[model samples]
Target: LPSQVSDAYEKILSRSKDQSWTRIILQIILAATRPLTLDEANVALALAIRKNEPESHSKLKLELWLGKNFKSTVMNLCGLFVSVYDSKLSFIHQTAREFLTDSEPEGTWKGSFNMAQSHHPLLQSCIFYLSFPDIDVFHPPFDLIDDIDGRIKSYGSTEYPFLVYAAKNWPLHFVSQNAADANAFRIQARTLCSATGHQRDVWAPYYFEEYPNSTFDDWKVWPDLTLASYLGLYEAVEDILSKEKPNVNLATEIGRTPLASAITQGHESVVKLLLDNGANMKEQENDGRPPLSLAVWIGQEAVVEVLLKEGANIDAQDRYGWTALSLAARSGQEAAVELLLNNGADIEAKDRFGMTPLSLAACSGQEAVVKLLLKKGADIEAQDFEGQTPLSLAAGYGKWANLWTMLRGFVAIVKLLLEEGAAMETQDHSGQTPLSLATEKGHTAIIELLLNKGKESKLSLSQSISA
Candidate 1:
């Protein structure tokens, strides 16, 4: 089936008048996160060429080029191999897409449809479109629809149809491509990072409106290396560090370093690069989380390993005294927990609230983490500052009506703890036993398990008394 589709694709490419342009257009369609509008695709293609041309000159050339080739329309170019429904482009069938994207296509298509190769041009075009001077006009004040003509004049009397797509999707395509060999992408990314005015004032806020921990205001002050690392542009980061030894530990307004940014995004290569180049691993962010804790919390086991090997303090605690192990356990990072345990992390390390790793795991209903902790000799009945045992916390942590599945998980943890010989009648500071807590939360299954265990304990007591 794929062979037949590949044959058709070959014939289509052969019949196309301009094969290289057709290939680039096809790549834009395949690499686009969503179905691109016709105008967006056209702008993307135009930007792919003449990237170094000034916006005004580029606009004139783009219009002339489009006018000359407009009759070669996308539908007519690829014929039956492509489809246009509602003005969005896609392949004729899902199988056609499959044929093109197959890891090991035969004949001429082998290694021709590389993902990095496909995304490189799109990302390049996006950066080119964004670098236009007219981007600043899209910031505010004027309504997008009503002020179209004014903006077009600023864009050399041409509509910048792909501005929004380019602004928002550049990061998506940036990460999709291999950054190791991309000196061009590295330069563009670094240039964007170094932009103090437009990137900060316009595109950063527009692109990262919903991104967590990103303050648009901070973009003005953050070091270029920090921003580049956060964006996960490995080659770009390498470029910045290579030029000279800048202070890698320099914090942004929010007190995050390049290392912290790379760690948060799980960019292993970048993290390692930062570490090898003297990024301080012990420097906590304003939130008080050390690099090791941040890596463990996010379940970046590879990054975690790198940090540990780099001499990151395994038991380093945050401001709240939550050690890396505690964060890993609470977040259900089983592999991280195991790795920390194997690395001699204090399994019984306590947070400021005296909640151990086992306590947090049980309270968070991490069944696998809970089991692993127990096997590693975690105190099953360890009490927190509030005197809540692991069993007590698990039994009543999320007993509310909406968390039915959480209650079930708590029930399982209760049974596991009980089988591991956790005391059934253990009480908290408020004197609530695991059974009483279960009863209060209306956790019927847990209440039953506690009751059965209680009955068995009492029976064993009576038999010993009789003997």
Candidate 2:
């Protein structure tokens, strides 16, 4: 099946009147994280050919080359190997991508397709597209346009259709291929980094436009190294480090170091490289979160191991006083929780709310973490500042609210807490018992369980009295 698919792909390429352009389009589609819209693909192709020109000139040249009927032309050129659905380009089948990317074709196409190598051209196109003149005008200080969304929509509609994709995805393409040794690639990367104004202008609008509710205030203080680290560009980090040692510990407005960026992004290699270059393992963010805590919360197990082996503080608390174990348990990061516990993390560490690992795990409906904490002898009757015990927390009491579907998790956790001799009559600061809390939340199963257990306890007590 794959051989036949590969053969068809080769024939499609072999028969192309413009083999280079067709291959570039196909490769762009193959490497794209999602299907590219017609506008995005058209702009991508334009950038591939006229990358050195201004954005306007590139569009003009593209229009001239492909004509107004470019959609049909592109489809006809790609032929049976590709398809267009709702104006988004993709391969005809999933196997086409798997076969082409997994290995080379059998005959004339042998040794031709390298999935990683194919990203090189797309990378070039994206960087060049980002580098176009006046591209940074959409960002702050220069962004005089009051109607930001309207302006962005208008610009994208009339000009630079691929700006958002290029701004956001350049790093993925940059890191996908081995462009480290290539001096041109290095220069291009550095040039983009050095153009801080241009960088923010292009990058921020794309981000804010996509996520309308997110704040961009703290984003202004991001240094080049921080951005590179956040983007997980390993080669860019190496290049920046080797050129001149920028402060590895230098933090952003939010106190996120390059190490923090790498850690949160799950870039283990970048994290290690930053660490070797004197990235502080103990450097806490503004919130007092250490590298280990960040790794644990983010569920970067390998990065968590890296930070631990390098001597990250196991019990360092953030401003909320939550330690790595506390975060892991709450987040249901069972592996990270186990790792921290094995490394001597305090099992009874309290957050600002005086919630223990068990309390948090139970409150968050983390069945696995709750079970693990129980096995590790977590305090079943541990009370928070609100006087809510683990059983009370598992009963869906206090600030925590369980969805109807998630109540099953609460039920299981309640069962575990009860099996461990958790006191059902323990009242929170609100004077609510576990059974009462369950009843308040309409958790009928948990209410019934508590009532049955109460009866069992009373029956055992009466029998002992009779004896």
Q: Count clashing residue pairs per candidate.
A: 0, 0
Clashes of 2: 0
> What digit string (tens of lDDT, one per residue) describes model 2 on residues 183-290?
447656765665354655665566546444433444556787887787777777888998878999998777889999899889998898999999988799888888
Alpha carbon lDDT of each predicted model: 0.77, 0.77
Residue 182 shift from truth in candidate 1, angstroms? 1.0
In model 1, where do residues sit more than 4 Å from their true spots? 49-72, 141-159, 179-181, 197-202, 212-214, 399-408, 463-467
Which residue pairs clash in candidate 2?
Answer: none
lDDT of 1 at 358: 98
lDDT of 1 by residue, 173-228 (tens): 88788655366677777777875646544456445534424453465577889988
Tell me how candidate 1 scores on lDDT.
0.77
Q: Candidate 1, residue 75: CA error in Å?
A: 2.4
lDDT winner: 1
lDDT of 2: 0.77
Error of 1 at 359 (Å): 0.5
Which window of 10 residues has the lowest lDDT sum in candidate 1? 149-158
